[model samples]
Target: MINWFDIRDYGAVGDGTCIDSPAINRAIQAAAAAGGGAVCVPAGIWLCFSIRLASHVRLHLDAGAIIRAAVPGAMGAYDLPEPNPHNMYQDFGHSHWHNSLIWGEGLTDIAITGPGMIDGHGLTSKGPGAKWAKRKGYFPESMAGMSAAELAAEDPEEAAMQGQGNKAVALKNCTQVTLSDFTLAKGGHFAVLATGVDHLTISRLRIDTDRDGLDLDCVRHCVVSHCRINTPNDDAIVLKSSLALGQVRPTAHVRIHDCHVSGFDPGSMLDGTFRRTQDKAPDQDGMTGRIKLGTESNGGFHDIEITSCTFERSRGLALETVDGGMLTDIRVSDITMREITTAALFIYAGARMRAPEGTPPGGIRGVRIERVRATDVDPRFASIIAGQVGTPVRDVVLSDIDITYRGGLAALNVPVPEKPDAYPEPSMFGPLPAWGLFIRHAAGLRVQGATLSTTQADGRPALWLDDVEAVHFEQVDLNNAAATPPLVCRDVRGLTGEMVP
Candidate 1:
């Protein structure tokens, strides 16, 4: 156990009202310059500017220690590091150069551990700017002194920028990192963003953010366990890969277990994919799903597992390959979800039809979902949407699952017209074959030991299969309080259900 105070003879300095960001940073730098060691922040309210971490350093905040972000503009100016090639689409905004509440880059074996809290002061930092941007229909014209338009107009590929948004912690190109036993709150963007790193572990952490709780991009072999991530914007925990089209570097072998995620609203979230239709330019937008893949899934994802997790009041689940990328060998088991408003699972392969599109059409094969239960799902649009327009979903199995729907399930076979004039738009856009399990344009799907129930008047069939092939259902139960047929099959063949058609 390396003691930070022993190595550098450092101690706590709290004036009670003012921040000690620079002092703590200087001490940490000095200690790191000598060799690797820990930098401890003793219990108290330490108002700080941004803190830049060094390699081989451990920033331990003692219990009850609250490290708050300094008032905006308190920290002096600093140069923005060069753009990380891995995070091109992630807009850092204007303040990409200055310090963060806690920031590090190219680090290894660093950690922030303790039973304490780190606040980003985002209410003060982001409220005015975000409000003004909303009114102006863009970011402000100027922030602090720099021209907001100039900053926004500057080419991300060429601009030398620093920090933007009051992030609590940002780790870039780091390895062997651990952040545990901390309460992170009120971040400007993401509470914790680990990019291009490996062997990372974030556990026993409570993250309540206005944005994403944990955003992992291009990372490998990571584990996020026993954490409570509550966010109003994007996914509570999101794992992503390359953004460039046709890039296939796969964020593989990741595991998320024993966590509670809540409050994911789909309407307000962005998936972080920017596509221009005429110019084929890329911009930033939030990707959908509480746990998602590809708006930027250029690199494929494989060997990922999510188990023993609980989701509350979520919009959706397991959004795989929205823009275009392959997702395989993924397992979701022993998961319980409640109060879901949207489809429980969405496997989309549509390409964002932009000029100079970069993504290739992708598919999901060898995916398994077992022992999953959901309740209070809006039946109107709650069902799995799998397979692409051309490349149908294949080799998927769902077993031992139970879903209680408050509304009804929507079919996944609505034809997406490339252009509005491609087909005569029909009236009475009827509810898409609302059912318990709806499968369309999929092949080789095996569903076993599942149950679905709903309480609605004029309830439709519990199971609806349309335009599908090679389906096998064994011991599946589709029960509703209302009197309705249990199964509906349209334009399908080779389908078998124990209860019959």
Candidate 2:
């Protein structure tokens, strides 16, 4: 007793030219009226405006089908994300979901399963332009430069939707969701943005986008697997916790595995053809495609695991919790990285209080990264784990890791900034104190069966420590020919380490 509602029956002309959102939405309504069923989009280039999903409905796309997003204008064909006071801390594109081409809110048992393509051909990641920013006359004189509560008091209807053409698929407060086997091209700000969702599964996706491939925010109990993503302009897979939900909702219990991410040409990865159309250095070009947790950590993270992932021509692995959340019990293993422009691994805990005022800095603890192999890493920076002044990252373990880098001579007395409140980035610290690994303001660090080698002669030491405690290295080898001492320690307490020079 399956109820199947086809879009073509609802007068959807899939000829790539007409606006078919009304007909597709009609089909979805029909299916929803029949007590939850499948709404099918057949094989064609179906142009649409916005497709909102209902509960217990699955939107399935046939092969060779493409849902193209329509362009917005003064007539308001597209909606803007709902405005909030916390949005000023984050970008406008990261604030809302209802304005997207496909979106769901407060839904249950919904899925967008596909073997087709979703092309955001006419979406803009940049927020409101100068003209739209000037269109705030409806916002009330008393509401000007006021708090979120104050602004909401003046305008209870929330008639402000500033930015347009942002995300491709955005979901909020959803559960038991699944997104699978879809190809996305030129996905605007983010290809997929999921927030406050539980029991979610995203797999077998081929995405070649202009911006971030997938952004999981405030999600719980999720699994992302078997995806090939190439974004020459932004991160491939990113996890974030922003204050968009009006409170702290940590992203936890997540597992991501068996994914291939690269900074290759946009369409090359999905076509099974490797092409290097990007001419800029992978790191220098601002095309960041890596698996990262937190540049937005107001809510914090917990119990996350990423394994068996491969990265090529992209940035390295990163873990950061800078806002007022506690990051704990994270493990990453079996990672193979090549041509990394940044450090092989970067873990940072800073004091960027992007949350409400008086929110304390976050913490990082119980992190384990093992069985990693990185080759052709840029030597300007080293693998780094740095905590803030008052709080140090605790109980970190690195085992069976091999990194071959392009290390050269480190200049004398390179000053690294302890930017506790600044933005957290690997390159933001400038040239690292060590050529291989730099440990700062950390405790209980253990490195076992590790090897750090250089492709060229380097005058810097292989390891350096500052404000660190209880560091023990076992069977660690520093394969450097020109360095005088393999290890350098300053203000470090309880260091029992000897490198196999």
Candidate 3:
């Protein structure tokens, strides 16, 4: 039985000026009333406020149709979800969902699918009502600001009505969700924010957002595949175990494959114009794209597999567990990265315990990375895999890896800081001690059939081992200049092959 309800029938004026959220919600209510069905939005520019999603209802946008977010002045027309006081524990964006264009909570069997687009016309990555300003190239003009306390003081309804939309789609405590075949432009904060969601399938989506493309928080059994994401302001695809739900919930059993993540110019990926606004890229450094595991990790990631992906003009693949969680059993294979501004691989286990006090530091183990080919890697910072002092990352295996770094004469005296309690970032460790690979404070490390080369003359060694034990490098090829030694060892125990045991 096919139960279908069109938005136009329920008085939705798709001419782009009418407030269509009521009609859309009414159609959704009618569809839900009839059990389960599709609430279809036909071809038109439907300017809407918040569109609340219900279970067993699929919001499908047809071709040439656009669900545009209403501007700040009209924000009061949207529906606000219940306020969560615990949102203070996380960042400003992760704290609320009711301020989004489309949001759902405690729902099941819901979907948003089609070839059409959901344009966050009135969303921003920073400040108040930021969407009102245009992104000239990289940095948008600044807007009025609010402190954390002031932001919390405003009425939730007023904030959504007068401020910028924070997200395009937000879902929490949901199951059996499907999001596919849609284009999301200028998605604020996150294009899709799924927390505590299970059995989710996200595929074939094109997202050129200002912030994160998709954030999976405390989600399990999710597959994100075949997506093209150009997020110059933040990460492309990220998995997190935040303390948003006021509990410890780990993100596990997630597979990300066949996706192309880039730090290209905004609005280019969607318009078939792949422009490069190199000067206007966000962050102190020009690194905004790439897949990341954490900055907000209370519970850790497990059973995660990332394969068959491409990264360009972005940061490297990062795996971090800093907040008293366990990260284990991860695999990454068959990846290619070009113009990498950072390391090809970064694995850090720190003591940034964001959880309740008295929690111990976390650990990362049983990880394997193979068949990775990276080019134009930054010569100053090598691919780093390190744990805290006395607490080593365990059983990491790298095989068949090839990296070509950009070499320039380096003084090679940058001290890596052990900011165990500060934020965990690839650049936080400062300029690396090696030119290719740097391994420190780890155990049971294995490297086989790996090659490292440089484009120009580099003064640093190809490999540096510090405080590492049970290490074995077999058939490793270090193509450094004749004046530079292939391996440099300091306080390394149980090492073999290139290094004297």
Candidate 4:
């Protein structure tokens, strides 16, 4: 029998109104005092402020147990965010660790398991730029005097996150952790924010959140498997290498597989409703939940593998290292996407050196993606592989891919700008000139056995290349547009390919 340290034995009343973090902390302390054991949080509504974690402790929540984050007020408040001098390099939410519902720093051999729920309904999720998804493009006049049709933007107001616990579970500088078999609802800014942690395994969790589902930054030797993440507002599962730990720590040797990422209506996944409520464009409010890497690539990424994942009602896969990080040796395969909103695949390398002022531009090399099948994808943006003028993305291979685009858009005559310092997004350069694939500033690219098709008879070329070097294709079926060329090449060198209609 497991000698569980029950929280109820330590003056924890499992009522919804009472603040139970002190009792829970006492239970954890007692478990640590006894040289580590399981801590039992039985079934009830346990309202808490901040629950700190210790080493070698497994918090097992029973069935129907709910650890709801308490509202910050006279009743109680969470721990204040410790000052981070390196806070200027990243967003405000990514800098702090202690201002969370459950936080741990510098611990070892910890686990948070069991089939319970963490409902962060009262946590602070006040998005400043736009309102919720209801008014997709409507902006109030109070939003800096901009009207509804302008599509205005605003910088994040950091002072607005005053005393609000924005993350459900936050860990920093820890090791040998496992989080499994739980349900997270309404996670405020990020459901789980893990940085500088190693040997972490996150599996079999259902996360339906408002913003990012899992933000793994500066982590090493991690495996994320068998998780279903739904985030309608931001990224679902992202790997970043921010300068959050006050140093350059690379995220390496990561493997993610057997996961399902989506962008559905909030609270629909948990309630089993599974509704697709947002009807606007992908950039508006509801459809950005895709697997990605970096907008904070300070330390770089290496030896990452992603396989056997499904995407639905979401944006397509993206790989980015714009903040001066080397993204290399990425292998992704066996992916299927349906109802994709934007580009089916996007790879970019830029000179956004968001690190300490002198960081150089990053490189992307040795990426192989195979057996990807996407259907009913957006037509405005194509799968793009782009780099800057001198530093081009190198050595990419795409094989055995099939994609179907909803392609009613007419090709417009416009020059695609190389936004070297802009945010790395698939839709960064508006409507692309091609309907299938667009390549720019790349080297040593090989495409084999691709079947690109469109539903609505697009007017753009199937393949467009510019300023690229050493391109090769084999057994690729290009679109047969009437009186339009199947391929458009400019400033390209050493092109050797067999293309068929």
Candidate 5:
């Protein structure tokens, strides 16, 4: 045996059934103080509170080793020191406390690697008195009883909602990290969230959670590959930038490849909740599955490449720039999907971020989706919808796509007027319906070698395009058993189709 044991030197023991966070953290801190080394959690189930990792330390769990959270209330035990300014809300938006199951900050060369399991006990910790439950409402209960300074001194979760506190693993402001070959189960929020980290690689991991499986926010130069993520609440893998009031720089240069994601809950998935405003209109809820980009993206993304992936039983592929950020130089190819409930692919550019009273609108540019196939999709949605809300989606391209719809195609942009005698103003908008292929409010779009087929009892068009510019459709085939048009185009300029009309 390699004797990777650190207990004899700076020991901490937990049997996976008892609270051992203090001992383990003490040992880790001791090792870090004496110049960094590995903290070994040998094969056993150790019940623990959240343990903070130090710089240059490795938390190695051997096979059969399981470290589970002790109880929900134990999270506030090692609350991080409050930031200066003594004002409770000074660091409110950027603070990292009260949100992570396993968290670390300002570390280097840190890892939690093993062929073991880290069960978050998410279902056990979901409701009130649970971490996530406290952050559900707009104002936290803890904030009511404390002054601003006292709230600052307390953990960030004391002031924040329970919804923001349910992440399983969070690594903030760290660099040179690698997480591989592990299984993370039942995350309260995101299974793994890495923010403001550089040179990170996450691979060969299996994450099964109710919330987002892997959420990479405000990070740069990272690679994720060879992973399997199954969640029921949100996107399997998500990349986002800071969407709060302050402007954190965008996360850039991200690459994701060779992953399998499915079985996600499409109804409750959402992004960009941090940007919600009281003045803005209410959001329309829909099913989201597979890959998604911001409803919270304020930090703009660039140089992203996704290749060789599979999506199963997802709502659809959503690339939304609603939060006033720019997404540029993005490429997706060689993807396969099954049982998609909504559009196969959707790109909206008219996503505007709620600026601080007086800022310019944000938009998305330079997007591409190629060589993708979707099977068994609901016909009410389209194979693709690429356009902006009011602005135009620019420089978009779709090539070599084969899609089969189980329902008829519909439109996504039909405006719904509010009833006059309703509640003063419109409380809801009608569904933005779509067809097999719906492209609206876009510029410089090209669709080549795209194929669509419908198996629904009702006959409807296989494709629909509205308010598009400079669109080219080459070698397109729409196979349907209905009398309706196979393709519908409205207000499009320079549209060329060989077999699409």
Candidate 6:
């Protein structure tokens, strides 16, 4: 009924010493040539450089099978990155698919389903910023006149990844893809980078990685479920709509549910260690493993739902559409979080405008987040909703939110900046003026059934509003640390609320 091609039948030696990617690719090609079938990778340590995938092929890895990615230029090297003149729009990793341990582009009906492990020990990965600026012809003023060798010595990982692959799995412009039931360990830069894909389903994946767990960029009609992702360095499951495909393709109609995101040390989740050994990420911030949307908002996000997720020792849920991408019709519910480094909930819409020229700044509207419970969260940025001066965030709702902040701040009237073109991080604004809720440059925001408390007493007001209109609060209880002035308002219009101190 169906064709099956085993790697062993195609001269594959899974001895850990031999480079078996060529043989694995042969089996995939054979399965593809046979009009669609499964390529079997049985139980063994199949050391590889890069294993390319094809259309209509299902790469099935049996239990105990391990596809370990060797260091580039150690045994063999991965495919060279394809040329992209539009790479300056996004990071270098998001622009290329070929330079990855497993990659596919412009195909259909492909899947990678199994319980096997992908060990990415030797791969190198680095995110955007000045470290990757050289790739995009951007050198900061800090490195004024450093020699090439000195630059290489400064950031050795960048030098090591030159002409090498850094991703675990990368797919681009494909349709009808499925990835499930896999254990991904130490995924280099990104465990999975799926850009411009449609009808994608990722489920039951346990990813404990060095960097970002999943980067879904400009994808459409996708569903991610039952995954446990741990990334102490970067985001766990981030939905981005970047200008990678040289077009404005909004990531729409996505549903993510029943997932667990954490900030445990790399490889500790699989080993059951769950250690907090690693202190800070490359950005010198606390562990950043959370489900987020956008810092790359070239294309907008529409009609997205995230429910039944848990966050452990990580950042909280964030909605950031800085780079000129509209965020609308999004609903998040039933989330539980602990040990949050940033805000329990952060929403931002700014005017970074990193897209092509003449692109207008985007705004956020019609968002509903409810049934969220967070504890031991940092009070420096407690639940922020902010927008630019001219472009205000609109029509958002936060319901049934119970948050306990680990508060210890003694400042009032903290001057906030209007960093319209700055990066959109929860802590971008240093030490929010409010201790519980900070709302600015927004309209039509409703907060109902919210119970806010703090472990330590805070000096600021429980609720602070600035430049907002039509804001209504019902059944709000600021329990222990509701300041002397429970509510503070500045330039607020049409505010109606009953705040219980």
Task: Give the Cα-based TM-score of candidate 4 against the true structure.
Answer: 0.94
TM-score comparison, 4 vs 6, better candidate: 6
Cα lDDT of model 4 by residue, 1-501, tens digit: 455899999989988999999999999999998889898989999999989999999888889899999999999788887887877567667888898999999999998997999989778754243221232222211232344354333334666566788899999999999999999998888899999999999999999998899999999999999999988778999999988788888889999999999888887877889898675332452287889988788888999999999999888999998777899999999999998888999999977666666678888999999999999989898899999899889999999999999888887789987777766777778789988999999999999999998888888888899999999999898653434678999999999979887
**What are the TM-scores, per candidate, against the unseen true structure?**
0.79, 0.91, 0.91, 0.94, 0.80, 0.94
Cα error, candidate 6, residue 113 (Å)? 0.9
lDDT tens per residue, model 2, 1-501: 768889999999999888898999999888888889999999999988889899989999999889999877643476656655556455556678888889999999999988999999977644431112223222222223567675443233323344356789999889999999988888887899998999999999989887789999999999999998988767899999887787898999999999988888777776878687685422243346789998788888999999999989888898999778888999999999998877889999987666666787889999999999999988877999999876999999999999999877654476787777666767777777678999999999999989999998888888888899899998899897784688888888997856688
Q: How many clashes in each structure?
A: 23, 0, 2, 0, 27, 0
Q: List runs of model 5 lying over 4 Å from the truth.
A: 1-11, 73-99, 122-165, 264-289, 384-386, 408-434
Q: Is candidate 1 or candidate 3 better by lDDT?
A: 3
> Could you tell which candidate, 1 or 4, scores higher by TM-score?
4
State candidate 5's TM-score.
0.80
Candidate 2 accuracy as TM-score: 0.91
Off by over 4 Å in 3: 74-77, 127-163, 498-501
lDDT of 6 by residue, 1-501 (tens): 779899999999999889999999999999999999999999999998888999999999899999998877646787877876677667667888888989999999999988998888767776433322323223322243567775554345433455576799999999999999989988878899999999999999999998899999999999999999999988999999988888888899999999999998888888999998887655556789999998788899999999999999999999989778899999999999999988889899987777766789999999999999999998788699999887889999999999999877776665887777766777767788888999999999999999999899888778889999999999999966534677889999999977778
For model 5, residues 467-492, the per-residue Cα lDDT tens digits are 88887888888776666656677787
RMSD of 3: 5.5
The digit string of per-residue lDDT tens for model 1 on 217-313 reads 7788899999977664446788776552123467788999999876643212123222212210011212222566544455668888888988776
Q: Which candidate achieves the best TM-score against the true structure?
A: 6
lDDT on C-alpha atoms for all candidate structures: 0.62, 0.83, 0.82, 0.85, 0.63, 0.86
Full candidate order by TM-score, most accurate first: 6, 4, 3, 2, 5, 1
Q: Which wins on lDDT, candidate 5 or candidate 6?
A: 6
Q: How does model 6 score by TM-score?
A: 0.94
Highest lDDT scorer? 6
Regions of model 2 farther than 4 Å from truth = 74-76, 128-163, 279-286, 410-412
> Which one wins by lDDT: 2 or 6?
6
Ranking by lDDT: 6, 4, 2, 3, 5, 1
**Which window of 10 residues has the lowest lDDT sum in candidate 4?**
132-141
Which pairs clash (backbone N, Cα, C closer than 3 Å) in model 6? none
